[model samples]
Target: MRANLKLKFEKPLVLPIHYNHIIQAAILKLLSDENYSRFIHDQGFKYEKRHFKMFTFSRLEGNFLIDKGNKTITYFDGASLQISTIEEEFMKYIINNVLLNEGIKLIGNHIQVEKVELKHMDVEEGGGRITTKSPIVVYSTFEIEGRKKTYYYNPKEKEFEEILRKNLIKKYMAYFGKEPKDKYFKITPIENLKESIVIYKGTVIKGWNGIFEVNGSPEILKLAYDVGLGAKNSQGFGCFEFI
Candidate 1:
């Protein structure tokens, strides 16, 4: 399930250029249930040593101006953000909390929820084209010179596809509590592939945005659509829409 939130503020919405953490915090703040909030925020669904939040969200969508000097973006009118998740409980909490609250305080700015749209998609036997709502991230960490270093992969790299497939399988296991009958999955860029660099908190992260041909098992494909692709999904990466 997906929830698209249309928001309006009395004044222009201004935020730092790297505002992913801020948006994340705002969403977590909406959870009225304390235990549920801590579970998703601190722990999440566990599989092996990994924790899967099973949700992803898009960047704010609207017309905006960038102040290079200030390193901030200001949206003139309003903005919308789409949140996707496979967990029905989490979806219910977000929708209910947002509707019940009079307004949302995002980064010290008061914004009203103008509208909320719910959507769902069916992935057929054959996969379809998908365009990213947020860039997909794939990376590896290694010990170099007695220090840990992170390397981000380009979409064209073979490792990119391999890691993505493996990641999805793990997510499937985490959610379904069983292995998928079919493990087949592949994603290839079709057009307009672009590299994106994002700063979350203070860490530099790399990702890719593009229209891609996603072919895979229907169940796994649907899971990818629901929870996003690649990595760092909860931190606003790998949200896509079927094209």
Candidate 2:
């Protein structure tokens, strides 16, 4: 399930350039269920040794101005954000909490929930085209000289697709408690593949934003649509929309 939230502010909304963490914090705050919130935050659904929050969100969309000097972005108009999750319970809590609250805070800025729209996307057997709502992130970490270093992959690399496929498979197992019927899945960039660099909580995350052709099992495709593609999904990466 996916929810598109339209937010209004009495004054111009000012935020730092790296505000993904702020948006994440606001979402967690809106959860009315404290236990559920803590669970998703501290320890999500576990698969093997990995944890999957089973949710992803898009970057804020609206008119905005970037202040290089102050390192901030100010939104003159209202903003819209898309949040998705495979867990129905999480979606329910988000909607209920949003409707119940008169207003919410986004980095100390009061934001009114103007509208909330829900959408369910259907994936066919052959799959179809998709455009990223947030950049798709795929990477691996390594230890060198007792120091941890991360390597981010571009879409053109073979490892990028391989890692994404493996990630979807793991997510499938994590959510369904069994492997998908058909494990075949592939993602290829169609056009306008651009690298996106985002700094989340002081960590530099490299990702890609573009339109792509995805061919896979309908079940796996649907799961990717709901949970997001690639890695760091719960941190606001890999959100895509069927095009």
Candidate 3:
């Protein structure tokens, strides 16, 4: 399921530029059903090389209200954000609670949600490949000699392209509990693809949010759209919509 949420604030939401993690944590706080959330969050493969969240979200969109002194952004009150996932119950919970709740706080004590509007999206399914209307973010990390390294996967780099492809195949297996072969889909970053370096909660992340082409089974492609296409999805990355 997918939803577009419009929130109005009494004043511009002043927050640090690297507030993505804060937003992610706020989303998690809404899931009061601890048992179900634990199942959804921790049921995935805990072994090496497979860590991901099932859902995805778009970066914030709106005119900025800037306060250069503290290096904070004051986003306009009517700004919007999009969240998506294949889990139907979770989507319902968001609409019924997150959006419905009055005066919810985000980022810090100052930013309060005065109003919310939720709109459901109708995305068509069944195609060999699909293009995203909104950019999809791709990212991952590697360890080199005991030091952590971040990678921004894009089609421009042939090796990273292959890495992304294999990573996605593993994600498919983890989600559906099926043993699937690699090459199930071909993910190609398209023209106008751009690299983005984001800082979330003091952690630097190298990622890309841009157009991508997916060639594979129609069902799998649809699932990719529903469940997002890459890692850190639940942290507001990799979400896509139909072109």
Candidate 4:
């Protein structure tokens, strides 16, 4: 069983926000130039898709703790929908209508309070080296409502998981100021393919005769293929050198 990964935060009551406002904030933040680009790239890496189609939505309802001795100002809760497809505009429509709005009947219904704040929680799962499960599971807690989420792709899973993970990170970073740093996520293939399990986007590799293979790794080979490293063959690339 996967362990439950969670985080929590608290704020004093000063102001209240209607559910619609939170949705708008999320949409505004996600569509921003920086956030969108990051979201796109991350999706690209995860889905291995030339283009990324994404959509998400949430519905929230909670109470703010109002007490001089206690500090709980705002509450947030919502569900999410993510999809990847070749049709770009179709995906955008879903995000704009369903995911962004969560079908909120009234934008004005947002309850305003004295104070405002946001809290966040995240669950993460990682898989590598079946024999070694030391870090297969990682749990991180956050103090703010905003936080980033990252997902590592397993070749065995459906094609879209990676893309979703990357975009999720972009979404979180846009909300939070910091991004999580994990050595596992940074994994790029090592010089020798036999020993390496994964490769990164911009890895540098040496081809045959110690020359940089112009075409890069071959795409057909099961073990090693074209990424940042370039093309390759199954057994060996004719005694090529590696970085």
Candidate 5:
């Protein structure tokens, strides 16, 4: 299940651009500490490249234009928050309770839930990889090695199809707890893909933002769509939506 949430702020707020971890902390607040750690973090690296987080979210959308000359800033009225999970119970519990005690305090400003739009798509049993309608996938690969290197489509390294397929298989085993029927998948890029970067944790973290059609296991595809794709999903990378 997924929720399109609009957060109304009690007062205007400002913060550094690198606020992914802070948003992650707010998401974990929806669940119990044990569950949060178990599902969102500290998932034993028992597997090769899997982490505990089974969900991903979109960037906060609101006013962000800064006016340095005036020494003033315009704040956004609200922000849209999209949260999803693989399990039904998890989604229901979090939605019903995330706002129970008090609203989420994001970036030192308390935000109230103004609106919510719930969406759900279930993969039928025996469903295969490609569905009747294809979805555009945009994912940000995690930083590897000592430096941040991001790639959307680097033909020099390898075809995007091969890279995405290999990563999806690992994610399938890690998140779904089973090997995927198809070991490989394909990503047909619909648009010109390129590399991008963002300031996270006070460093230049490489990333990719583009769209593609995923050809793989239907169940795994849905899981990727709902939860996220690639590594470091909880830290906000790889969850995609229809373009």
Candidate 6:
């Protein structure tokens, strides 16, 4: 099972808000469901400068809400509202205005979100049986420091590729606030290159993804190509290279 908290904020405040606070609030609310609901009904929060009256609730996906005045019902995954918090009747006011707009109050706040997950293992007899099955194949390129290396694997390929992609995305998102997309499908091979060097060869394809060290003296980078050729082409094979 996976758990996550989401929040909705009033527009036009600070240029950038660290959505962490909204996540924290949702976590505390979920942990203290009954008590938190009672608190909101009783000692609600108020703001003077900005009359942002916000009420949050939690709901599962695929829920429905009905508007009594309009005699309309709507299904929604999320919702948000704006109102004044000065008076004790703010909730009533919001209901009279926004909720009356054929909107049903969504459970929990809706905005930037964070996830907290829980997992458990299934235990069963004969669950660990092994079979002789062909492994998945993956072709990956990696870079360390300034050196570059490429690998081809059948089974363990995903392990290395995931690690490398995770590190790269983490570093990139930390600085750029977004993740990088795959570039393999977009690459055009540079064939019959005159200036080229063979880095590694004869590597046994084991898993979908794997990491391999470049043979010979390590200079700037090492790369591996999936040489697609018949067993007859082993000696003096027609080579195809990727740039």
Report the number of clashing residue pairs per model.
Answer: 0, 0, 0, 24, 0, 18
Any runs in candidate 6 off by more than 4 Å, and if so which? 4-17, 33-243
Better of 2 and 4 by lDDT: 2
In terms of lDDT, the poorest run of 10 residues in model 5 is: 127-136
Whole-model lDDT per candidate: 0.90, 0.90, 0.63, 0.26, 0.60, 0.26
Off by over 4 Å in 2: none
**Residue 18 local lDDT, model 6:** 18
lDDT of 2 by residue, 35-135 (tens): 99999999988889889999999999999999989999998769899999998889998888888885567877678989999998777766888899999
Question: For candidate 2, which ten residues in a row score worst on lDDT?
Answer: 101-110
Q: Which of candidates 3 and 5 is the stronger one according to TM-score?
A: 3
Could you tell me how far off, in angstroms, the CA of residue 215 lies in candidate 6 after the best superposition? Answer: 27
4 or 6, greater by TM-score: 4
- Report residue 18 deviation for candidate 1 (angstroms): 0.5
> How well does candidate 5 match the true structure, expressed as C-alpha RMSD?
5.3
CA deviation > 4 Å runs, candidate 4: 1-22, 25-58, 62-106, 118-157, 166-243
Which stretches in model 5 have alpha-carbon errors above 4 Å?
Answer: 33-39, 44-46, 66-75, 123-159, 192-194
- Candidates ranked by TM-score, best first? 1, 2, 3, 5, 4, 6
The better candidate by lDDT, 2 or 3, is 2
TM-score of candidate 5 versus the correct structure, residues matched by position: 0.75
**Scored by Cα lDDT, where does model 2 land?**
0.90
